[model samples]
Target: MAKLGIPAAPPRGRRIQETITQLRQRILAGEWPVGSRIPTEPQLVEALGVGRNTVREAVRALAHAGVLECRQGSGTYVISTDELAPVVARRLTDDRMAEVIEVRRAFEVEAARLAARRRTPADLAALDDALAAREAAWRGGRVAEFVEADAALHTAVVAAAHNGMLAELYASIGAAMRRTVTQAMGGALTPDRHVDHARLVAAIRAGDPDLAAREAAAFLEPDPGA
Candidate 1:
């Protein structure tokens, strides 16, 4: 028998999952931008029309997944837009630098080849700008800035590939890739030993897939002796 004017509650597990989905949708919709504090418990409960426990569990789940951060007395904040990025960051440990290099080489080579085939005039312009900025940054003798510029140059190459999925995958591991570059530099950006991207950009410009791929692979090959 049901009480008058009362609705039966959904199963707790289902309620929690539903709440999580609602929260994620709001996030992906950009209602709650990254670095902005999400609604408090009472607000979430009221807005989501769910129980407090359900909201708590959903928040906990996202926090564990690295999509949300909680600071005492501050509140929960969005740390990342992509859920998988944090997972990749956690897995790409310091000792796996070799594996990181290998992965990067594979990604860069394929991206170069695809960019050669698909790049438009706008893509070439972007690549030129990115390469110029990278060179200037390296020549300026700042290791951190050079690393950022290098990442930007490679990202431009991937964008020229015109493959949405590849771009998304590249973005997911972007932070990890930056860390790999920083560690590989060993606290110095040597002038003579810098990885020149001129040939890679030129090959892409020339529409030579083989040359582009080779150019990409040249800098990223892992030492067999290691």
Candidate 2:
């Protein structure tokens, strides 16, 4: 320690990180609407009272989080908030299981439609891999492992849609619901149920979203008392 010393260096990176977090929170809070242009780098520097590098770093961080899109010529803009919800709330809420089913219903319905239209040979292969993993889990009495594959199969449907926002939303919900679904199914996803998955793949191969959607919905329905 010096008897007389200069002030400490600013915590540039931490400040920038906090600024970015606040910006994302405001966007999710709807203070910044979807597709709206955020402040320019210079403007953010002024508004945040930070250095230019700080603002730029914050913007880059937000861009990487999928909340902001930065174009070369155009300024940054808010993308979507589907993935920005509180993960803790998702995990702790009792009603979330029902909410998951509802969201799954709407999302998978459209996902099936789009997947059937868009699924390629590679997508079919991914689906097959997930199903095979799930079948092996059932046979081995590994309920947790099977539930993960079930989640993956649903995620594969959204991924097959080739829509970034939908895929992100499905992934978030899948993470939140894995344990609940495993408990609900209770090690009872039988060979016949696995056959339903095979049929779903067939529907996608045939480019029939309606049938695929129906099969997906059937699998998600809550078991009695489950």
Candidate 3:
């Protein structure tokens, strides 16, 4: 078993690990930006000098890690550049309902405060439109429409903050946030709910950060003992 000046081949597992590391390095280095489609499987195989199986496994690992997302009838795309994206994705999948609601509350309250300080006329107009849609859905007894409008209003508030990172984070958990909104609404269309929404919008429009934060917290507060 002796061949002078010859190196031993790396183990299969080690080779896969190396491949994964290389791919991750490329992705994190901005060779692939978030939301951009990655190289096709064959291209990756050729470029990485790895077997198709190895390339597929590396891609799957990155996808499960939330750095990439595979769309049906389309190629894989980078979903996030953050190394923490996988952790956040896992937590969102595993966190309890109350925990999810708490996270959303924190983000929304801060977003409201920032929106009050940063919103422009266009932002205010969008918020007003969202509010109007919500009220219309409520009065018309359209439960699904009401839930959608409620979520849109909150999204508008966050967009008004003009913080790209915050907006991206909020968007990442959008589905969970929508579910939380629907649950919080509980199929009710009360006048008090409309009043609370109006007050929150007014606070933001007036550029009162403290009042806006308070109003947002109160608006999103969960029912006691729910």
Best by TM-score: 1
**Better model by TM-score: candidate 1 vs candidate 2:** 1
Separate clash counts for every candidate: 0, 0, 0
Residue-level lDDT for 13 in candidate 1: 94
Using lDDT as the measure, what is the rank order of every candidate, best first?
Answer: 1, 3, 2
Any runs in candidate 2 off by more than 4 Å, and if so which? 1-92, 187-195, 222-226
Task: Please give, for residues 159-204, the per-residue lDDT of candidate 1 as tens digits.
Answer: 8998755665665556568788888788888865688899999999
lDDT of 3 by residue, 1-226 (tens): 4379687767767778888898878877878755446899999989999889888888888777677767554468666666565566567754466777777889889999999999999999999998998788788876667776776788789889988677657655655665666666677766555544898899999999999999989855775887
Question: What is the Cα-based TM-score of model 3?
Answer: 0.59
TM-score of each: 0.65, 0.58, 0.59
In candidate 3, which residue ranges exceed 4 Å CA deviation? 1-90, 93-95, 187-195, 222-226
| lDDT, model 2 | 0.70
Residue 80's lDDT within candidate 2 is 53
Comparing candidate 1 with candidate 2, which one achieves the higher lDDT?
A: 1
